[model samples]
Target: MGKASLLTSERRNRSARGTQVRRERVRSAWLFLSPLLVGLLVVAGWPLLRTLWFSFTDANLTQLDQAQWIGVENYLYYQDGAFYGVLADPDWWNSVYNTLFFTVITVSLEVVVGVIVALILNANFKGRVWVRAAILIPWAIPTVVSAQMWLWMFNDQFGIINYLLMGVGIISEPLAWTASSSLSMWAVIIVDVWKATPFVALLVLAAMQMLPSDCYEAAKVDGIHPMRVFFRVTLPLITPALLVAIIFRVLDALRVFDLVYVLTSNSSSTMTMSVYARQQLVEFQDVGYGSAASTILFVVISLIAVVYLYLGRRQLGISS
Candidate 1:
């Protein structure tokens, strides 16, 4: 009976120890997670909540303390005739059209040219290291510097571009690339494409380098065409990485400010949403209206990010 009683006591002690260990584990997990939760609340949550509140109120920079709870008055103003007039204005529409046009043309060309460049860089060639370094120089240059360089190149009177074109008999007179609204947008697109294509190439080239060589050897053994192998095997394998690169480029294009601001000086033909919001908020000092515009842009970009996340998860599952 004494032996049995001692066994029961031992079992009780083991159970108690297990429970204590579990409690300690739970406590440690919470301790580790606490800082991250606090950081998210402070950095992301607070700013978003504040922006939403400001969007609803008349929170101008000067009247921030005395700002009234207008309750969607700013949003209503955006829907009113004057706001609609701004929305419907030819110059506003032209800017929107130009922004979209530039994004599409530049991104499309970049992807195509970037892929070709990546393919060439993937091959074993003489001076390949130097070539890669040279390609990255354009992307490494500051946007402001790039803009100034392009501006100088596109100058009509003393520009190298005009001199070359005139010397080649392409045109008798110097052409002003930035003077006309129609040409100005394309000029900006060309400069953007030149500066960004290297980024796309590097990303794709990295993905290509990580691909397994055995698969390509198998394709060769099976007598598959090179183009067919690329489409069926290479593209499918690297799609997730390519999608990530494209999404980044898309977001960058949407928020484009520095290059456009420096190149065009917020001209009606080149004014992006960021330029417009900044002009109203900082330059014009219409804080309430500017906050509303910025809030909308934030929401739209957030939605795009959410969509990319969903698609990325779906692709991951498929790849797995």
Candidate 2:
């Protein structure tokens, strides 16, 4: 009886020691992470809260100090038997449509092309090192610089794009790629795909590299076709990486301003939500209205991100 009691006490003591060790580790982790948490609060949280606050007031760029609280007037105000503000504005809806269209198209194209490029890059070939380095050149270039370069290439007169198209008899003359409303969005999309595809490719390539090689070897010994192997074996393994890439690209594309603004300026055809917010904030000097738009944009992105992650988790069979 004494020996049994002693064993129970020892076990209890060991469990207490383990629990104390875990507590210390958790405390140390939080202590190390406190600086980063503080920085994020100061940098992002504060600004977001300020923006939300500003959205409820009648603020302007020049008279920000004298701004008055107006409640939801900037979002939707009822006056004189009518509705108004950013919510009722046709231009705002147009910008929302433009933003969604760009996000969907760009992300789809980037993912498809990126996966193809990643597959090619993963294969063993001569001069593979140089090819891998060269593929990243477009992504490495500054967005502003790339946008400006493409602007010139898209010029109606004496541009290389037109030159090559005419050379191939694709068009009779130089087309106004960035000037026409019909073509401006396409031009912006092209430049974005060129610049961003490399980033997705790199991510997918890294994921592919980490895959176990024995599966491929075993499939090869079984005389499986390459396409079949890719569909059945390779694709399922790399889906998580693809999901991450898509989420990142979707987030980035939704908030796109620089590429569109630089490429198409204030053209309504290519004006994203960010561009619309900038126009209201900077050009029109309506801080409250702009802040309202920005808040909506933030909410929309957050909701979409949440929905996407939830769907992704279900697809991956991850328990909540």
Candidate 3:
């Protein structure tokens, strides 16, 4: 009886100790997470709340402290014909169209070119490391610097681009690539594609390198054509990474300002939503209206993010 009682006590003590250890682990995890939680709430949460509050009030920069409660007046102003003319104005629509056109064309070209470049870079070649580094040069350069370089190249009379094209007889006369509204969007697109394609290539190349060599070997042994192998084996496997890269590029393109601003000086043809918002806020000194527009942009971007997440999950499930 005494031995049995001692055994029972020992078992109970061990179980209690195990529970205590688990409790300690939980407490430690929470302790470590507490600081991060606080920081996120302070940095991100507060600003978002403030922006939401500002969207509702007539908060001008000069009279920030005296911002009157305008309720939904600011939002209504954006909906009305006079104040919201920026939305439906022909110039505004032209900017919107140009922005969309640029985004679509540039992104499509970048994806195709980037994929090809990535494939070529993945192959074994002499001086491959040097070539890869050279490819990243444009992407590594600062956006402003890249814009300036391209701007100089697009200068009609003194530009190397025009000179080269003329030397090759591509054009009979010097063309104003940036001066003409019609050509400015394409010129900016060309510059953007040049600067951004390398980034996409690097990302896809990284994904390609991570793929299993054995899969390629198996495909080769099975007498699969290179094109078929790519579509059947390679594409499906690297799709997640590709999707991630595309999402990042899309977000970057949507918020584009500096390149367009520096290159085009907020030209009617090149002004994006962000550029428009900034112009209203700074140039026009219509803070209330700008805030409302910004709020709308935020909502649109949020919706896009949600759609991306949903689609990503679906794609992940299908791939799995």
Candidate 4:
């Protein structure tokens, strides 16, 4: 071969070898990951498939073995195509509305309150370490334990909340916080905000701490106001991390079960999507209907996540 032909053949051989090596590496990685993938398929995938199947059938806890497919009757248009199945169930709709409302209010409050708390904690102050640790106390508390604790605190007859309000002359009579429909949801929201805001704060504080000090120094040198520096510089840089934290809290709040269940058990006003599904499954023994609700909840959450991610991408100028 000529000099140019020899060099070209060598380059081709090298490229082929590189491609083979990459293929082998990818195969090895997949081989190592196969077990974990199989485990996930068994653990998560199987149950999801089972739930989907049950959602379309007449399954019951007692007669689970005798599941018989009855199409979408569990979900909609059951009686003469007039009475909606779970779709027309007022309690289910109420639970959905409660979930959406709780998600919006709690997440909004958490984000705003968390940003403030993070900013405070991020500053140089005496006992800053202790204060940061102390703020995490509420987040560390178990949700059920926190719910129960708040439940007692909200007791109208002898709760500390009532006592303080009465002492301050805010109200002459003790208000029923949990039992009253008007107050029950707010009471739950208060407890959730207390329990979760610290977590969001911690996340934001970590993000804030990682930010380059040069930005602050440059802004200071330019005579920029501290508030302007925050909104313009600090907020923009930490937007990604803050978005992730908000999304996590939103998903958690959407499917909330333990706090509402433990705090207000069966209260129509406080019933969330998760609690509603459980009530149908365990309490009413309507497994099929409950599974349908569970499926719908999953679809709703998935759609919300997709929309959120799409918006995030659009805002961040991501193509895919």
lDDT of 2 by residue, 74-121 (tens): 999889999999999999999999999999999999999999999999
Q: After superposition, how far is residue 203 of candidate 1 from its true place, in Å?
A: 1.5
Better of 1 and 2 by TM-score: 2
Instruction: Candidate 4: list runs displaced more than 4 Å.
Output: 1-25, 78-81, 318-320
Name the regions of candidate 1 deviating beyond 4 angstroms: 1-44, 78-95
Poorest stretch of ten by lDDT in candidate 4: 76-85
Clashes of each: 0, 0, 0, 0
Task: Kindly report which residue pairs in candidate 1 clash with one another.
Answer: none
Clash count, predicted structure 2: 0
Best by lDDT: 2
lDDT of each: 0.82, 0.95, 0.82, 0.93
Quality of model 2 by C-alpha lDDT: 0.95
- In Å, residue 52's CA in model 2 sits off its true spot by 0.5
lDDT, candidate 4, 1-320, per-residue tens: 59999888868798888799899999999999999999999999999999999999989989999999999999986566578778989999999999999999999999999999999999899999999989989999999999989988999998999999999999999999999999999999999999999989988999999999998999999999999999999999889889989989999999999999998998999999999999999999989999999999999999999999989979877622
lDDT of 1 by residue, 154-189 (tens): 998989998999999999998888777777888888
If ranked by TM-score, best first, what sequence of candidates would result? 4, 2, 3, 1
Worst lDDT window (10 residues) for model 1?
80-89
Task: State the lDDT at 47 in candidate 2.
Answer: 87
TM-scores for the candidates:
0.82, 0.90, 0.86, 0.90
